[model samples]
Target: MSSTKVIYALYNDDDVLMDAVKQTRKAHHHIEEVFTPFPVHGLDKAMGLAPTRLAICAFIYGCIGISVATWMMWNIMINDWPQDIGGKPSFSYLQNMPAFVPVMFEMTVFFAAHLMVITFYMRSRLWPFKKAENPDVRTTDDHFLMEVSVSGDEEAMIAFFKNTGAVEVKVIEKH
Candidate 1:
């Protein structure tokens, strides 16, 4: 398999990291990953990442949950059991819908949350309790880090990194 060389730069400032990403793109170097203590808005656009579709998926999943829960409830109470209880009309959903609202809401939230989390994890290449590929742990807590993949002219990439205010840079190798 073909692999690329990557360099990690750690910085304490989020602004500097944002600027660095813009500068790196300006220099036309390909950056592979960015680690930040917290989210920095607009970094995705700066990195040229396409807008995510997870929200759409979440919505669809929520709709599915609602439909299944509603259908199951109606089918069981009206078709399977076919029993009216406590002077309530079980055969008519419009009259008994207040009872199913809680379940429908719960199912919607359940499906949305679980499916959205799964979609996010898959999209981010993350799994439960997975060790990070990043070398520095501080980047997740208090530092911003950028990883750039270098090819052909590494010197130029190094210069570009340094010029963009990278506090520390370390080369990573593939075995």
Candidate 2:
């Protein structure tokens, strides 16, 4: 089987990883991926990744949720089976809007949260029982790992990573 050579640079600190990322970008080296024990702030910006549109999607989902909640509540309370509770039989949605606020808020939050998770999973191509793609298991503990594809001289790339504060650098063939 054909395999591609890649350099795996390990860092003990997030700061070092960030600096390495910047240096790699400055050197015009493409970073295949970065694995960190936890979320590193501004890493995406440093990597020059575009802003995510998840917020926009969440807003749209919230709108749909509120609309559904409103229609359901109106149909049940005003149109289909008008309630005559507390001697308020106006059957007007606007007049009874305050009473539906709780349901609307709940539905909005539920839809936004659930749909956003689904969107993130689908966008990331994650699924149940999928094999892990992590190159190094240390990345899941206290270390950060950067995967850089080798384009030219492997030794030069290794030296570059070492100069960029990598605690350990190794070249591996990925199938």
Candidate 3:
């Protein structure tokens, strides 16, 4: 496969960046990625990205946590050593489920939150001592960066980006 050339467009304002994204899509230019200092609402829909499935993963993790909590409580309270506390019966788990409700709920929340964080970290390839891959440091502050892959022509793409209100346009050839 041949190497690719990418155009980096820098925008100072989020509103201008949003409009540029819409215009680029309408012009049939493939937008590689967009970097922003903060989340831009409705930006994903404009870029035609698929909806995230992280919430579904969280729900699955929550179910696992509740199941573990129930099993542990049943074994500890009813099966291992039956003890009467607060005049509540310990013979049947169902009879004492009300008391365990707090524990169950806490565990569910804990697992969903912690595991989701870990999953995000892993999926993003984030780890201690990893170097950052941001092309422009200004994007982490107040600027936005839009990367577009150039196919046939370079000057026309640069002109197109300038017309889209890019503050700076740089052409990068990737190895």
For each candidate, the alpha-carbon lDDT, in order, equals 0.85, 0.93, 0.94
Error of 3 at 158 (Å): 0.2
Best by TM-score: 2
TM-score of 1: 0.88
Q: Per-prediction count of colliding residue pairs?
A: 0, 0, 0
lDDT tens readout by residue for model 1, 1-175: 8665788877888888999999888878788889887889999999999998888898999999899899988898877887768888877877889988999999999989998988888977898899878678898788898988876677777777877888888777754
Q: How many backbone clashes does candidate 1 have?
A: 0
Candidate 3 lDDT: 0.94
TM-score ranking, high to low: 2, 3, 1
Q: In model 3, which regions exceed 4 Å deviation? A: none
Which parts of model 2 are misplaced by more than 4 Å? none
Model 2 error, position 82 (Å) = 0.9
* Candidate 3 RMSD computed on C-alpha atoms after optimal superposition onto the true structure: 1.3
The 10 consecutive residues of candidate 3 with the worst lDDT sum are 148-157
lDDT of 2 at 90: 49
Which RMSD values do the candidates have, in order?
1.9, 1.1, 1.3
